[model samples]
Target: MFDPTAFDNIKFMIQAEVYDRDLAGLFHVHSRKDLVDLATLSRESVITFSLKDSADLRVSLVVKADLEKLAGELLPSSNALPGVSLHILYFGTERSLMAERMDLLEWMWGTERRYERKKIDSDQTGTTYEWHVYFERIITEEMMDELGDLISFIGESLRTVTETE
Candidate 1:
């Protein structure tokens, strides 16, 4: 019998929530990837989706657990905590909306998470802006129930972004 790691459990839960939304016609999943690095023994899951009402802005949810976190979960003597990092990515082309996005993010997630905007050069759009939402602390299994709320926030955030644009 193989016991799943904490990262696997959380990833599955997140997928279930996102897929349910997709099935409900609220969101359209764009891409999904579950990756494992053999050399580093790290695990990562990335899922991107767009709101059914607006495909212009896409939201990506990323979950990651490094080797230390995995070892801490599986080994009893390991001192490292079994914590996973969560990130929300927003993709858009309007740089002028930076202030609005910042306000929306602050209103949705407060000041707990860090935010960063990066500029990407593109042919289709003069420049694309990618917003990253990073959790200040790694998430543990104890906070699993909050995952659904996180998904809901993403959905609402997408809708808000579309309405403003």
Candidate 2:
């Protein structure tokens, strides 16, 4: 379960970096109060926005520098060094990939051995699933707290995950 409210916190930080040029710089977000160690966020501006469910979004960001290494691989045009603006497109690619893999795995391992409620109903309706992912800001308070825990865990710890059928 992913809380949509908690998403605001993450999306805000990202959007702030993209639209506001002055917001560009090296920043390290830490948990509890550990200025002792940090990771410097690369210096550059970033733009981000969410779109309607049915609408496809195509966007671009321009910056002052010609060296474009920081701008991401959005365009083939060589960019200025120490690039002024870096653009990252978030078109539900992450959530989609996660959903896709979950579907494939469940499909491959028919709903027999790993038994549950004796039935699994696949539907286009969003309300039917026990666990769901959303790009929209629709979350509960408990889920928000859970999200915080997940962030802290993921932020400070790094681990490798290997998937096998």
- What TM-scores do the predictions have? 0.92, 0.18
* TM-score, prediction 2: 0.18
In order, the Cα lDDT scores of the candidates are: 0.86, 0.28
Model 1, 18-47: lDDT tens digits are 999999999999999999999999989999
Off by over 4 Å in 2: 1-101, 104-132, 135-137, 140-143, 150-161
37-86 per-residue lDDT for model 2 (tens digits):
12443332233222212122212221112223323323456452222322
Runs of candidate 1 with Cα error greater than 4 angstroms are: 95-98, 123-126
The window of 10 residues in a row where model 1 has the poorest summed lDDT is: 93-102
* lDDT of residue 151 for candidate 1: 93
Q: Which residue pairs show collisions in model 1? A: none
